[model samples]
Target: MDRPEKLLTTAQAAEHLGISRGTLARYARDGLLKPTLKLPTGHLRWSLEDLRRQMRELREQGGE
Candidate 1:
């Protein structure tokens, strides 16, 4: 089986993606991004690979 991917907090994710936290949240709200996990307490988490995938998609469309 594959190992589980590392998950990132919102701040870490935003920094990793070179965007501000508000931009990350806006991307989520605008349907441009989705969290890899949404906790029961409503906190968000992201997989590094998923974030990379989203960036690739956005770049393909010139949305980045």
Candidate 2:
């Protein structure tokens, strides 16, 4: 069976993506990356799978 997806807070997601929190927020604003969840307190969360997929796509497109 497949494992459940891991959820990451904005800071953790940014760190995993090798980017700053501000940049991650910009990407979300630009629709480059969508948050998996937004808590009632207004915090963003991202799925590890989604981040990994984006990284793979970026690599395929010759982006760092």
Candidate 3:
């Protein structure tokens, strides 16, 4: 059996990325970062791996 990928809430994702929650939301809205899931309560969740990948890509591109 395989373990499921870790999922992060918006705030958690923002903190992990060292960014403000609003900035994270803006990134999602702008399509810079996409949410892995949306709950019925309208909350967004992101994959930890995906976030890390995006951070690496941003670092490589010289984006802060």
Q: Give the TM-score of each candidate.
A: 0.84, 0.72, 0.77
User: Which candidate wins on TM-score?
Assistant: 1
Candidate 3 residue-wise lDDT at 59? 75
Q: Write candidate 1's Cα lDDT for 1-64 as tens digits.
A: 9988789988899999888988988888788888899899977899978888987998899895
Q: Flag the better candidate by TM-score, 1 or 2.
A: 1
Of the two candidates 2 and 3, the one with more favorable TM-score, higher being better, is: 3
Kindly report which residue stretches of model 1 are placed more than 4 angstroms away from their true locations once superposed.
Answer: none
Model 2 residue runs over 4 Å out of place are 1-3, 58-64
**Model 3 lDDT tens row, 1-64:** 9999889999998898788999988877887777899899989999978888887887798876
lDDT of model 3, residue 48: 79
User: How many residue pairs clash in all the candidates, one count each?
Assistant: 0, 0, 0
What is the C-alpha local distance difference test score of each model? 0.87, 0.83, 0.86
| Of candidates 2 and 1, the better by lDDT | 1
In model 3, the runs with Cα more than 4 Å from the true position are: 58-64
Predicted structure with the largest lDDT when compared to the true one: 1
lDDT of 2 by residue, 1-64 (tens): 9988889998999998788999888877777777899889989999978877876786798865
In candidate 1 the C-alpha lDDT for residue 18 amounts to 88
